[model samples]
Target: MKILLTGITGQIGWELQRTLMTVGEVIPVRRNEMDLTQPNSISGTIQQVKPDLIVNPAAYTAVDKAESEPELAMAINGIAPGIMAESAKKVGAALIHYSTDYVFDGANTTPYTESDKPNPQNIYGKTKLVGEQAIASSGVPHLILRTSWVYGLRGKNFLLTMQKLAQEREEIKVVADQIGAPTWSRVIAETTAQILSQARHHVSDFLVSKGGLYHLTASGQTSWYTFAQAIFAHDVQHSERKLQNLIAITSKEYPTAAKRPAYSLLISQKLSNTFGLFLPDWQKTLELVLSE
Candidate 1:
């Protein structure tokens, strides 16, 4: 199968290139090659490639910066995927898109399900929700995977940031109130490959059965503070880096331009039952990521 993948340089997209290559011929397009902010460029790129599957890993991921640049966020994260979906529909191809747990307000005490109502509290979440809505409304066979707390060895993510800070400072302060599952980009890429390899069958069943937005994350939950501690501990054991102290603080203390959900943990029972795929715990995934 011929597959066209966007955001090839991103954390997930970087891993996806390796995973997807095992299944089919993957044509990865970077941002410089194909700008997502341009609607016509998105449509033109897809039409030119005419891929059998379109995996869009690119998105407006700057949470704080999105507050000041809502239009650009909407164009890249909201409308672009819809345009890709339309192109996929025209050519009878499957479209796979990634979303975030921020689509919902963290007001719920329990983990959110696919059926949960989305009330995005921030501009980033609202824009991603708009993208999901556009894809669903396009009447194309699509899979929207809503994930959270994504990190990897590469890219500008929490893991790399923590590693950098741990090297420079003796103590690190992280928020302990916000809780969610941390997902490795490698895991997401592997799962995406697994799903896409069986795309023909899964797409057919998903259209008639359980298809739409599904939560894809690690099996457990933890706050940022605890997660940072784990990272430090792991590094101390395996690497030369030694952390002196790691402090836990509330979200209010670590203020940002955007308002984050207190708790946005997503339950993935639906994805598990439908795809027969269950991701490992966050700790286990972290170990693998760090080892790599």
Candidate 2:
């Protein structure tokens, strides 16, 4: 089988290249090769490649910046996926897309479920929600995996930022009001591979029975302060790093253009039941990530 993968430079996309290699020939494309902003380009590229599967890990992920560039965000995160889905349908190919937890307003006391109604508060969230809707509306085989707080060893993410802060500053302050699971890119890539493997092997029932939106995040939950503290402790024990005075503050203290959810933890029960897969705890995933 042949697969067309986008966003090869991104954290999850980068890891996906390696994970997806186990399945079949992967035609990984970067932004230079296929610009998502141009919907016409997407259809033409997919038609040219004629891939059996399309994995779209690329997205407009700058949460704060998206507030100012809503049009660009919508174009890439919303309209592009629809175009890709349409093309995928034309060629009888399946599409796999990634989404974020920002789709919800973040007021829930419990983890967000697949069945929850999406009420996005920010431009980024709205755009991603649009993408999800487009894919769902398209009569194409698709899987929308909504993940949260994604970090990887190689990406410009929370873990890397915290590591830099720990090295430069004697003290650090992190938001304690917001809570969610910190997921690793490697783990997400592996899960995507597992899901793809299942789909490829069980072709008849794959899209009809199990192709839909699902939450895929590392298990457990913690505030940003707790997560930073854990990272510091792990770094000190594993490396010669030393950081002091880790302060936990409320969200009001640090302001951002976008209003983030107070609690955006996603429950993976539907994903687990559908795919027969379970992710490791957040802490364990962190350990493995840091070890690398």
Candidate 3:
């Protein structure tokens, strides 16, 4: 099967290239070839590739910067996936898109389900939710995998941020109130590969029975402060440092342009039951990434 994969340079995309290679032809589109900001470029490129499956992991992911650059974010995260879906439908292809838990307000104390209403507190979430809606309405077979607090060894994420700060700074202050699962990029990619390989039997049947949306995340939850502590503790060099100086502060103390969810943990029961796949705990996944 020919699979057109976007965001090949990203952490998830990079891992996907490795995991999805054995399954089929994984074509990683070049940025210049398919600039999401240029709307026409999306459909035009999809038409040219004419892939059997379109897996889009590309998105304008700058949370804080998105406040100042809503248009660009909306175009890439909000508009691009819809165009890809429409094009995929035209060619009788399937789509697999990734979303975030930020789609919800994070007001709930429990895990959010696929049926939960999306009330994005910030522009990033709003745009991602828009993409989800667009793909669902496009009448194309699609799977929208919603994840949270994604991090990896390569990308600019909380794990690397905390590691760098721990090694460089004497003290690091992190938001202690905000809570969510920290999903590792490799886990997401691997799970995606597993689902795709299994769906090969009857792609249309899989879409009809198990498409739409699913919450795929690490099994457990924790705060930023605790997550940082875990990261420091996981790495011997960083752990030996005066991590005692690590301070826990409220979200109000460390203000940002975007308003984050206080709690956006997602339930994976649906995904587990549907695909027989469930990711390991956040801490376990973190250990795997750090081991590298």
Error of 1 at 39 (Å): 1.0
Per-residue accuracy of model 3 over 1-292 as CA lDDT, tens digit each: 8899999888788889999987788899979989988878988888888888989999889999999999999999999898889999988789999999999998898999988888999999999999999999999999999999989988789987887776677888999999999999889999999998887746656786779899899999999999988988788674545545889999999999999999999999999999998789999888887888
- Tens digits of per-residue lDDT for model 1, 205-265: 4543545788999999999989988887666443545457889999999999989999999
Error of 3 at 61 (Å): 0.5
- Please provide, for model 2 over 1-292, each residue's C-alpha lDDT reduced to its tens digit, 9 standing for 90 to 100: 6889999999999999999998878999988789999977899999999988899999999999999999999999999999999999898888899999999998899999999999998999999999999999997888899999999888689998998877777778899999999999999999999887887654325876778899999999999999998887676443545566889899899999999999999999998998899999999988887776
lDDT of 3: 0.89
Candidate number of the best lDDT: 2
For candidate 2, report its TM-score.
Answer: 0.97
Off by over 4 Å in 3: 239-244
Clashing pairs in 3: none
* lDDT of every predicted structure (CA atoms): 0.87, 0.90, 0.89
